[model samples]
Target: MPKNKMKSGTFIAMCVVTVLFIVMPLFLQVSVIRNAIAWILSGLRYQEYKSAYLGLVGGLLGSWLAITGAIYTQRKFDREKEEKRAIEEKRAKEIDKENIKEICREMLWSEIRQNDNSLSCDNGNFIKAIMEKNDCYFYNRDSHRITTDNWNFIIDKVISMDLELAIKLMHLYKYYEFMTDFDGSADSAFTKSQLDFSKYKECYQDVVEYLEFPWAND
Candidate 1:
């Protein structure tokens, strides 16, 4: 049988034995049990009638043990569920990291070819025009001035197929965009901001147009 059922059967058997040995003899007027009870309660004022009190205490203790065991089992189940959730979250993060790596690799090589004028003639001028429009400012702490090196580094890294480096550069640009507006203005920093969308739109269009490459078809 199942372990739970076996334990329940054992407890029932024990309770039956206890009731037969203790409670049954008390009502039957057994001499030996009566003498034992009398000796156990000899020092008490209510010595002749302590069996009921003792039985009550035993009942309370048994109920407490059962309740405590149930609480412990519930906690064990909750802990197992929490551990399983953590494992699933960890697996999902690993899969996301792998996918990001693959996308970064493909985009990097495509940028490199486009930058070097090695891409198809139809797409070469389009890529160069978009790169020219890709301008953003960066902080130059050594020079104590804001400059456009952030945009330059991102473009270079992307063209070199260094996706990790490109992401880092992009973060730097985002940081400065949030930090200071050299344009001298005090406004809601993150509320409403403008982006030069021309370059972005052109690049996206180019990507869609080039999606029919022979390798991509395969």
Candidate 2:
């Protein structure tokens, strides 16, 4: 047995000896120990018929507490299991989204890298096509619009990922919107010479650099 059990047994034995010898013989001369033992026994037996209901109430209260404790423990375990499952599912989704982002980056950057670097008068058509207020520009027509749907699917996810990249992408979006609005206006010129190309180049580089290569191909 454990030391606590041994100690408890020894203490109980000492208490019994004290009750039988010291309390019975020396301290309680009028048989007080007997009276106390009888009183305890009578209480256990519910002394009178009318008072018996109190014992039943106490028993029912103890049972209700035990049932409550059991329910609480089960609920706690279920909550922990649910939390673990949610965490694992989120991690798996992030991994899948990261893979998709990599593919989109490769396609977008492939076009950006190959295109004209200089902001000369020679690249007017390419610039307007990109900055045009239509589905074609936002869909990345110059890059064959490859994986554009996949790109949209992960955009919010990407914004939540990298701070620098998110800032760059936001600026690029603002510029794109500005160009679209400008192109729609009657005051707009036949040539988009007023637009700055270097600013766009920086945004593209920031986005491309932040994107990771797909695991299978990398």
- All candidates' lDDT scores? 0.47, 0.48
Which candidate number has the best TM-score?
Answer: 2
Q: Tally clashes: model 1.
A: 0
- Model 1 stretches astray by more than 4 angstroms: 1-48, 112-218
Clashing pairs in 2: none
- Candidate 2 wrong stretches, greater than 4 Å: 1-46, 49-54, 115-202, 213-218
Global CA lDDT computed for model 2? 0.48
